[model samples]
Target: MTSKPFNKFRIMMKSLMVCTALLGTTFLAKAQTWHFGPKFDANYSTMKGEGIKNKFSPGFQIGGFAEYNITKHLAIQPELLYSWNSYKKSDDFLTYYVNSGRSAAGNNVNLGTVSVPLLLRYNINNFLSVLAGPQYSYKIYDDEDLIKEGKEAFKNSEVSANFGFQVNLSNVGFYARFNKGLNNINDIDDRYEWKSSHIQVGIAVRIK
Candidate 1:
């Protein structure tokens, strides 16, 4: 079960990467002003669900982005980012696991995802821009010790929306964004729905 699902996910991600590369190449060939750079952010993230606590855990996202200017005030930026997220569940909700011979594991769910967001950026000034976009993510990192994959506890993919404001100064950039999950990630029988969200603050260094 795990083998087939993991293989399919890997193949899909590879295809997505190919498509993104091809699109970026086409944009470059069109004589567009493209800025490529590295980005890294520290995030406060958590999940919302019936049994989950409304608590945030510290994590980070690190990746690169390509910004293509469409006009003086408009641009499109596509980014490939990897997110590491963690959250805690209610102790009452986790007691069941303790009774069932599984370790409580601090009721923590730690996972990692690869996300791609194509943002439409609107420049408000020489030093500021606001961006919003739809994002697709695949869960490639999992803690098997806490959540066994053989049981298929969570969905492998997620769809989300991202909106944010960025400040730019020369080659260095700073931004804050809200990432809201649009689909329920609960895969173990939908009696209760679970979704994730994050607040991210980061810096980007563009190569001119």
Candidate 2:
């Protein structure tokens, strides 16, 4: 009985060792072929007007993304981002001072929002890919120099659609994305419907 038990123990140990070796090999293969990374972004923004032309303005965004490989031809990317989107307008100094009782030449309105995007990427080659997805955004802050005037507060939430492309290098990637707001950035009683749109470019580094 003792001899039989010893033989069984020996067989179990060998099986365990083989399983461990296989698992280690699989882990190494996955590590060598795939990676995930963090991303950072900068943006140029402008409002899209239905009947008016709006000028382009400067903006920025920062974010991180997890990239997963399905094959040499495809991948999935999901990201969480904080973006600043705004436009600027100049006012006459004498008119502004006389009307608003504030001694200022010109003023600017700045709007800030946070967004999350999930994208599906189709790789055209090792160097290029195209991405498209839906983005959800919330307005966190908006500052206006003429708020002391009778202007109401700015809107607070936004929903948008996102589309873009990615360029991949040895251990880094670059991307450009465009976002269009689906909802108004202002309330119903506001004079104009504040439509938001932006273009973002970013760099990414692979860590895993």
> Clashes per prediction?
0, 1
Candidate 2 lDDT over residue span 50-100, tens digit each: 322266678776555666788878887766666666575434323423443
Each model's lDDT? 0.77, 0.64
Model 1 regions more than 4 Å off: 1-32, 94-106, 144-150
Which run of 10 residues does model 2 get worst, by summed lDDT?
92-101
Candidate 2 residue pairs in clash (backbone atoms < 3 Å): 35-208
Candidate 2, which segments miss by more than 4 Å at Cα? 1-35, 49-53, 90-106, 145-152, 188-191
lDDT comparing candidate 2 with the true structure = 0.64
Q: What C-alpha root-mean-square deviation, in Å, does candidate 1 show against the real structure?
A: 5.0
Which candidate number maximizes TM-score? Answer: 1
